[model samples]
Target chain A: MADHEHKDNEQLGAAGFNRRGLLKCMAWAGTGVLWTVNGGVPRSLGLLGEAAAAESHAGGLTFLQISDSHVGFDKPANPNALGTFQEAIAKIKAMPTQPAFIVHTGDITHLSKDKEFDDADQAMKALKQKVHVIPGEHDVADADNGKAYLDRYGKGTQGRGWYSFDAGGVHFIALINVFNFQPGFKSAGLAQLGDEQLEWMEKDVKGLSSSTPIVVLAHLPLWTVYENWGWGTEDAPRALGYLKRFGSVTVLNGHIHQIQQKIEGNVSFHTARSTAFPQPAPGSAPAPGPMKVPAEQLHSVLGVRTVNYIRGKSPLAIVDTPLSA
Target chain B: MLRTRAVLLGGAALSAMLCAAAPAVISGGGPALAAAKAASVKIDNFNFTPPTLVVEPGTTVTWTNADDSPHSVREMDGRFKSAALDTDDSFSQTFSAPGQYQYFCSIHPRMVGKIIVQPAGKTSSN
Candidate 1:
């Protein structure tokens, strides 16, 4: 560790939530982040330190994040997306410890087809853990405006399928930002959470104490990663305002189809890798889409994110393990 | 700052190496046109190549998804709308009236493009 990092860790003291320490080390690792929370403070560790992170959190609560499955997609970038999805499930089954649940951060299907949804659901059944899902553009990008997605997954969610739940002392919020594509330009603008969802979010977290750790799951990035590609949420600043009171907030997203992390004050933003294919990193290509790699090297860029939360610790340790790795 | 520089550099290469050229369209249709003239806009690299296009009335503009990501073409006014387009998918709209049509990608608001329908004799110079 560098001298400044050491000083930053030391400054954490009783809080033990070295935000800067973790942020400074947030280099884009092909592997995911491992998060650990101690004493209501969240701390992050890289993939190299997953074992240590797991060992310290002996009986911690863990969850998995699998995103951008694109189940029906069959293209040069990934001819057999379903096959890769099956591989992703196998990886989850092979985990040393089973996660409490799995949160799929949207793009469950390629064209929101019924069979695509069914195939994705069946593939996910290989895992024993419970699964929570939010819609990605591909999941709800149909003529019905997500009617199919809402019918299957919007059981307890609010308008368009935004919902929150409390599990093991952590508050989990699944938001739907893919609901508002312009009537004509279908996929041109940034994702929108709309006013109704934002108002509901404000009231949903109003009662929680400031120390409560919050995990926000959505399909689109709440922060501005790339405006030209609509890789961000337009009303995210308002939504984030509702979470500003909390000591630790972690936002997990999919859509960009790559692993990227950002830290700002109490909130940490993370976009996970796709389970089926990889997209060019922001500004790396002409536009964001499936990035084709050598056939054998495809799995190296696609993987699942595992997040572990240790009670009383503010930081959530995230470990992103690629399927091939 | 570094990332911005990189993106700018990439933008330079994108224009030079990629196909954002204007599509050719033969002009000769009357008010009661039988076969509409055809032009195309390629949706690649998160942009509508030839961000602005000029065509005569009775022209059909097709937007094709050349990139792997899905996209849709929507007009600002309630004139045309397309379903989400997957890779290699396409949508076409026939413009009959002579007017300026402004549109954007609903999923990517920053991607704005315009279509100008000139009178029979006029051509798009801008």
Candidate 2:
């Protein structure tokens, strides 16, 4: 691993490129690529080698994003969802620079059973960092309409497990969009943030300065992506409208189970991969479900994301490393 | 367990009747016997097979999930709602009254279905 990291640094040095040249030549250099934003333009800094090492030592705030663990899922796609989730935890435990915390975007269980929540909790207990979680639709499937999820994780949260906090000079807001799923109630057949949560969010950021970097975390995509598959949120445009005053806003979501990113004005939206099993790309399959890939390639398609924030930097740096890589 | 066995036997009997090309006389059964008439809805590839099912009153509608994802059967008017059904899992609802009921998979709302229960003694419109 050290040799690979060294080689990556050597290639960049050999190019004898300035910052502008590096930005122009930068392709998505596979796994471990660090993405930083400057003037709302994202640049991929290939490989997490010297640059990441320096940032870690410089006291930057780094965190992990793990989503869709689906702890009770035991299907052909990936027979041991819990096992893979634990493997992701192990990877985070072994990171060279420990992250400050972890934000699990949701789907923490398959059926929202008590035992499934217990199993996922036991596995997550292995991580040294505190975890911030929002419920995926699966987590709230209990007969009581999410009472089970609220019992265990609802402390300090408001209105169906949404809350905000300040971390590393960044304002972090966790929203819940996987509710209000009664029959005939429709949000274009997609997830929704609802009126109460939207109002709370508006007041949540009222005191923040325009320069404050805001990170919005939810279980579903904040923007519409493949409406037929329910991959996007219905009222996300309204929620996003509130953040327009902020100079830098990053919305992190997880329900899609694959990485899809979009940039609009000063906002950047990113979806993370699932730790349980991969789903087909939007509109690629007959429907959106656990996508069965070649058994050998499963690990490569499933992994975690790391985000680093430096105080003076305009936007946070994001690194996505596959488990196999 | 008894309910499951009864539903299975009822399904078998229904299939046999259909195979024999007999007139569907699914009426005039006692309370115990009335619970035996079964109609099925198959959930595969995120869509309900036989999306619109018309059956005689007192027929039990069973939804079987065949896809890898989990789905729940919930009526639009909140008459009945099932827990999440994983692959091979099934949920059954007995419609005693005659009316049209709309339902959808609460997990994936895009997948919708309908059930119409006509007055007793009428053949299934299907």
Candidate 3:
């Protein structure tokens, strides 16, 4: 064990969380960042360490998903999103399964502020689990110059910012679709993948076997959730088409900050509830965006999803449990 | 800032996105047309501040798109639909008939809201 780990363990100062290879203090070109890795995935080491220790049991395809933390949002709905994110961590610690990996669909922070990123990283570190992420519109909202959201999260990604990885017998594809903001709406300029990304995707999937189950992680909805509010992706058809050959597919997104699920053919698309706040369901309001729920109801709406994988199971069962549930 | 406006306006239409620079003012198609009782609704991120509105019949309820995106006052469970408006574009639809008109943005169904067109000659105290 290293000096820090050995000293912290002796003093009982450390939470004894799985720090493993989580914090890779790699020296980057610009500012130095302590990049952490979990299960061969780079992650923000926040509360994940301690949280990881608490529920490091419940083995076999155990993973957690939290979306739309919206850290910088200061509104009546959630006065301090950072606080709610803590509440989410508390839940993760309480879970029976020490998930092998953690996935944050997008919108980790509201304004993509460096502080916000740090805060999210700090909180997630407690989990002590592998964390994979996609970027939501909010994260890139106030980015500087061309240092857009993708630049920060788009490491080793496709031209349009799409990337895929292999994990525990499953192929996870992180797609960027929030960029394809349609015309005549609130979205500025455009928000969608260009031709380059699409072509890469075709090539990316060509190597995978049809039997491999693919999990698509993105910020926007791959299916048409709500067009008026730009909830759905504009060029998702091509992206979805690439996955047609796959046997089982699960697409997870977070921009909507609500739970909307649909099963088409062998694919299942699910929009996760935001750990920050809950938005009204589709067609429940005059527009599509963040909807504030009452304080008491926050826990009920915010929670986690437990996905289990069996060698020869007919289909993967995804159990979404809200805090209230 | 745009999101706050949408919530404050109570789902009011946007002038920039919906009507191309023309502010969407509710149509005053009522007996008190000259004295149109104006009310504003807001659409934030993708939610209606007031998912369902209760207004007296003939009340000109204007939906303002205070958010950066365009929204419409389409009738969800009724016979009314508006074109996709851009940010700042506004749309106004006066309630001439008395019924529960569920409206939403055809472009974004999750951006759903309702207008309770009350019967004429009656006033909504609240």
Candidate 4:
């Protein structure tokens, strides 16, 4: 993708275009444009803007998203989740190109046992890259205040394990909405980002320019995919409001252990497949849980997602590759 | 004289009395057979088999996790709560108060169940 600002300027030199006219010009360019405001005026940049602009200095940024490892689970769906988890890691190891890091959305274990965490830790260590993890309900089912999870993955996170970081000119926010869930509904309970975290999130993004790409990571879906199964977050709208100003937003989650995607305006929502086992599609079964599949077909549904960031062209370019595929 | 002759010849009145008593026998000696009341709600397929149950005020209700996943029973109004129960694990609560108590699994909220406790000494018909 190429920037046409200088060429377009020559053609429209004395015309003095309005906002609508500029957008029309952007469309005419036939390329994804990243729009930013400078000095109270809107300007468009070429596809693969800043992130790719530095390809010579540092390679193009790429990250792997893996979730629902369920290390200790021993069920018919996938009797040895640990074995499949190793397969997932092997797939990452065999990738022709390496990702900068791996973000584990949640559910690193079936039960938050020390051995489970240890198995997950040893498996993830094989990748040899930084692994960022948030907790799923299963990880905290045995520990109060998430002491067990915190001891492993919650080193610098604040208030139930939510934090943000900057990588390759893109902002990534890791949130925890699985705590204090309202019980008896279904699945993971309608996810919630409490008042304290929501307040912190608003201030966190207050200083970011709208052009910066924002990636929100949590265990449960931020939007209402299926409330009856507690597959949605209750107060995600409040958290989303803080992100409205950003030009690009991508939300990633993994409690459902299926591949689901949604795009709303400038925001895109994606739930990755599990490395442990497959779950039935929403409403396809009586409820969401370990969906036993034919032994041969087990690997076809569980895998990891690789996201490539091209600056001006909507930083989130997600490609899901199953263990078999 | 005609009624006496009919009863002696066919025994129709006695048969009718036995016919009426058959249902009572099948229903386990009427509602007074308190030992046979359904007092447990089996949680399987992520649901409460009998979504609603009725029993005497002093009856104890047991919820068993028959599914392979973990679950918990929690009262909607904060009256009772259970810890995370793995497969085959069970939790029980006795309803001494005569009222409706709604509860759900904390792990799977949609799996809701209701228990109606009748007044003291009253047993629910199966």
List lDDT for all candidates, in order: 0.74, 0.77, 0.59, 0.70
* Candidates sorted by DockQ, best first: 2, 1, 4, 3
- For candidate 1, lDDT tens digit of each residue in B35-64? 668788889877887776666677888899
TM-score of predicted model 4?
Answer: 0.71
In order of the candidates, what TM-score does chain B achieve?
A: 0.69, 0.69, 0.64, 0.64
For model 4, residues B1-126, the per-residue Cα lDDT tens digits are 322332232323323323332222111123343453347888888888677666665566778988888777776655666666768878777665555566776556657766666654433311
CAPRI rating of model 1: acceptable
lDDT of 1 by residue, A130-200 (tens): 89999887887665657888899989778778999998889999998987644224343677899899899
Compute DockQ for each candidate against the true complex: 0.26, 0.32, 0.06, 0.22
Best by lDDT: 2
Task: Give every candidate's TM-score on chain A.
Answer: 0.87, 0.88, 0.76, 0.80
Q: Give the CA lDDT, 0 to 100, for residue B8 in model 2.
A: 33
- For all candidates, the clash counts are 43, 0, 92, 7
Among the numbered candidates, top DockQ falls to: 2
The regions of model 4 sitting more than 4 angstroms off are A1-58, A143-147, A184-189, A311-314, B1-39, B52-61, B75-83, B92-102, B114-119, B122-126
Q: Model 4: DockQ against the native?
A: 0.22
Stretches of candidate 3 above 4 Å error? A1-59, A143-148, A185-191, B1-126
Better of 1 and 3 by lDDT: 1
True contacts kept of each: 0.45, 0.47, 0.06, 0.40
